[model samples]
Target: MTRPHDAAILELKNLLGPKGWSMERDVLETHNREARGKFEGHADIILFPASTDEVAKAVAICAAHAIAIVPQGGNTGRCGGAVAGQDQVLLNLKRMNRITEIDARDFTATVEAGAILKTIQDAAEEHDLLFPLSLGAEGSCQIGGNLATNAGGLNVIRYGNARDLVLGLEVVLPDGSIWNGLSKLRKDNSGYDLRDLFIGAEGTLGIITKATLKLFPHPKHIATAWVAVPSPEAALDLLALARRTTGDAIAAFELMCGFAHDMSVTHLPNLTRPLASQTDWHVLIELTSSRPTDDLQSLLTDLLGDAMEGELARDATLAQSDAQRKNLWAIREGIPEAQGFEGGSIKHDVSVPVSKVPDLLTRGMAAARDLIPGIRPCPFGHVGDGNIHFNFTQPLDMDKADYLAHWENLNRVIHDIVAGLGGSISAEHGIGQLKRDELAHYASAEKLKLLRAVKAAIDPDNRLNPGKVV
Candidate 1:
């Protein structure tokens, strides 16, 4: 039975036409949940807007009726940001998947909100350019969602986060007005930078309908190597050495604990050990150059040789071929998925200063183990950038629910350590509903007041993504 909200639903249905909107149960069910299965809700209707104008019209209708709007993109967020309540309307942007333009001369790409990250990457590659915002979910995650949450991935060490890669955005304001600020120019030092406001707002401040993203020259020569470092400190030292030796040629510097790699090898098929010797810590390093004559392979080889000689690395393996390079990356990328085969894993995507990464890992691991004896720590990620996926797999043979019950307690313990180290509880992921309370707890009263003021100024009605972020 269609609920009493059918009046508004019918109005939206007529406005969007049958193809653009749906009140179907299956669609609502699919759109109402987050990827992590941690948060779930219900939506009376789901609207699909193909263009910015259509999005504005839908927002206007929702605004007039005082109906809450939950703007979603690919529904790939780890947090409950995209989940909608029964009272709210689910606004899915997948149909807005369009690469409007690729300006190779200006080194920018104009894309609709729903364009998949991989699609944009391919489009840029076709023009012999690169869109470096890459993550494990690149295959499915959309650029809008990436920009909304200000995603930071493997390339963040070199390219920075999603916000750093964007030049402009076209947003639909809370009252149905559109902000056409999609400027491709590099320098637009106008009054306030409003583009930065919505980038990491997670759809709370405004709905991001389109974006103009920065691009780079495609790397012509690339080199990849996996080195077994002595410790997190050693990994940091190697990162410094690599940067000094290769200059800005260091494209990616990823750190993985030995146990994390072992889990990958144990669960993921076709992924073998990259390093010959077993070390407690590992770092996957990559160097790229647009100039084919750069000879990145020799540079990486020399860096690894020097690191081993300096005792920073216990052992090292440089990729001899393109196949070998991909194999090495596969091991790194496969860790997250392989972890699922273990058991219920409590995950924390935290970031500290690069100098404090070793301290965070050392102290955090000890604290978690002390809290729950037999807990397995699988900490890894962009250590060069200070963001670590500090995840804890359940103790062996432990009940999943029982282990998960300690999620909040364990989070406090780990987050307190992160706080002491002057780190962020969330690095890449934004403060969605999952971290909303935590953000309130950690953020100062002045910061919270400013956040609320911004939200009130822009969205006084509180109709856009209510109960999220601030």
Candidate 2:
């Protein structure tokens, strides 16, 4: 039996006053769609819980009445995990923003779900510590959302993803039970490891309210450089060279194709070219060390000199200042926006083994162009970690809608190549409405069954973010 909408709205309004809830259409429109403007859904009511108890109470009320609840944070997710269907109640974590604790001795920081990524990073920086999981959306994206999607970004090559950085989680379960598992211990041998389950569940199982995250000692010496390479193979080779020279000090190694760099300069403002020679490939390498006395620049200089002699690097430019370093990064960071201006683009956040990146790009590019004549493949991303954001801008003189019409076709071509290389189709982006079918098609039957079983066990009613990442 369908519950009456009036009764539901009245009950929610009484339970959470004007400070805690909003049923206004204009205000709720922002929460209807996703960050990419891809999928949109309606939630007549949105609850802004300021604390865990409120979130739990709101969930309990909704759970008893069999109303779906969607957990949202910052609404900066690339995937549509935060969106909800009609009549559902949206639980926005933004009001819960708070930095509860920062234990420098324990190397842990506890923050509420609504705390923005940049705010946490700033707090950590104040204490000469670092929380390295960072990305383009750090300024607006929240930590809970990052954990839900298990986001991977620039520092992933050195610091790992959101899952790795989290030490413990405080979540409001589907049944409205507040699970206080916020442990700050560096090592815990307790059984079940339930904290890991909710890390990347996309809020289907539970809503993360607070998190205790691991922090690292701030790096003393930092080095940044941009290198020009002849091919993807050469970029990979240069990555190996830098790894051998600097070892674990290498923080990020992003590869950008010449076309990608050119697009950035032409489409985006203030994005001047970084290298002297325009090679087919460009590598943005950064090195960081905790040792204050370390000479990162000299080390990088020697490594690049060797790479040049060995033909691994065609040319390179080292950033002499912080501003220069940012300019070098701007070229790679502006790929998404730059590509947006070029025309309609089909994006694939896929990953293959570093050893197979060259083959993957070469084969994938050839296959895509063959499928859509004159198609331009702009494959670039975290080359050191083997995760490439392979996107295709439409042909120079093609219709935007015509290019967009081939999204599925382009995805098939690229994902097929990724699968053939033993790679993942969705690397950092969660399996939201965008890639639900693709995930279902590619994931093994056993894996799918196991995932579904877990979801059923945790959220049998499917009240939390229905029709998403199941």
lDDT of 2: 0.89
Q: All models: lDDT?
A: 0.91, 0.89
TM-score against truth, every candidate? 0.98, 0.98
> Model 1 over residues 1-470: C-alpha lDDT tens digits?
12326567777888788789877888888888689899997887789987898899889988877899999998989889998876888899999999999998999999999999999999999999999999989999989999999999999889999999999999999998999999997888879999999999999989999999999999999999899888999999899998888987988999999989998888988877886688899999999999978988888888988997999988888888888888888889999899999989999999999999999999999999999999999999999899999999999978999999999999999999999999998999888998999989888899999999999999998999999997
Poorly placed runs, candidate 1 (over 4 Å) = 1-4
How well is each residue in 289-400 modelled by candidate 2, as lDDT tens digits? 9898999999999999999999998898999999998898888888888888888888999999999999999999999989989988898899888999999989988999
Tell me model 1's lDDT, rounded to 2 decimals: 0.91
Residue 126 error, candidate 1, Å? 0.4
